[model samples]
Target: MNPVATWRRLLAELLGTALLVTAVVGSGIMAATLSPDDVGLQLLQNSIATAFALGALILTFGPVSGAHFNPVVSAADWFLGRRTGTGLSLRDLAGYTVAQTIGAIAGSVLANLMFDLAAVDISAKTRTGTHLWLGEVVATTGLLLLIFALARSGRAAVAPAAVGAYIGAAYWFTSSTSFANPAVSIGRAFTDTFAGISPGSLPGFIAAQLIGLALGVGLLLALYPDVAAAAEKVVIPAERAARRQRAASRR
Candidate 1:
């Protein structure tokens, strides 16, 4: 791949992630402030904002960088493509992860600044225990399953809406409110707000998410054995359509 293309992809990942975290943290802050007396209302408002923001962001960036604002998604793509050498390169994986992590943190800081808070503050919310871990596992597993299955079924075009809808629903169903993405989890830890998770709880959440990633991969392989076809479907629908048109014109 061209170095220029690689850099452009990395920048897209970074900006997408930053905007995503900003939506999460900023909305959480607003929700908490506006509905200080009603926790349920606060959660509802935050979840709705997050869902809409995520769908918009993915639609905006998927063509450029797969819109994998989550590290687990990126890692899964790399692993599934390893044998065929058609997915992200190891260098791309590393760069994406680093860019996402940095973007997440920066997003938290930006949200805080926008709300007239400190740039960075440790969260006090402690989310732990077996049930929460189980929630994390279920959330992350379901997320990966949804993404890969869509790719395998050649429905990547619907990913933005499907993913966002799933996440919004998971927020109500999952005990942990679906902190399924490791990068987002880390970013939330920087805010001492309604959406923030304590730094001490970060390791456990990440571990559960990783376990979920493994399970999701196993399910993907078992259900979609044609890895090559699945990989090809990862491209956005517009690009795929254009390529088909070009091929037909050539013939």
Candidate 2:
């Protein structure tokens, strides 16, 4: 319940997400442009690049933040008893989401500037396609499962590396090559560039991911009976700031 611990976790997640989004979107774009001959192979290469970047980030910040740069992972961790215990309040959610959004936008912006990427409209996501939807399902489920297993055995120390490897493997198995983070998925929608999913198809793809995440949680519950002890409640943005103000006032 320490304030310092909360702050450190917040900062760590922000840093990790910033690095993650940049590596994911940036490398993805580069691969697509550099190897337009084979879209599938380019995407696979990009996935490997993302994995390595993520692995490095985790090793750097995992101890400080548990390196849960994704909301899903953080929420899952809280559900499974891995939260830092200052309490995963709405304040945490607000802080985390704000940072994540900024990081995603900035990452996309940087990628655009660096690679001459086109500005894709928000509504363009509709073309994500059925294959992408299937990919999201498989990728997200695999990601969550990897996180759950690594975290459960106190092997969380190596979570970043383990997570990166899962992603690399998932890329080969899934057709869409995995857009696991919702924020990143939405951000990628803005670029009509090589990595953008069709805005119209975003909903279906996201839905599949949500279902996959649910299934993953169910599997973990059965496999690791103690996982629920880590569940963290989703904090509504507006409510969290007020709660923090009140807590500070009390102090």
Error of 2 at 225 (Å): 0.8
On the 0 to 100 scale, the lDDT of residue 2 in model 2 is: 28
The 10 consecutive residues of candidate 2 with the worst lDDT sum are: 232-241
Which residue pairs overlap in candidate 1's backbone? none
Decoy 1 TM-score against native: 0.93
For 96-138, candidate 2 gives per-residue lDDT tens digits of: 6666656666666666767765543342534556777878877
lDDT by residue for model 1 (10-85), tens: 8888999999999989999999999999999998998999999999999887777778988999888888887887
Q: Candidate 1: lDDT of 47?
A: 91
Candidate 2 wrongly placed segments (more than 4 Å): 1-8, 82-87, 118-126, 229-251
Off by over 4 Å in 1: 1-4, 235-238, 241-251
RMSD of each: 2.4, 7.9
Error of 1 at 126 (Å): 0.6
TM-score for each model: 0.93, 0.78
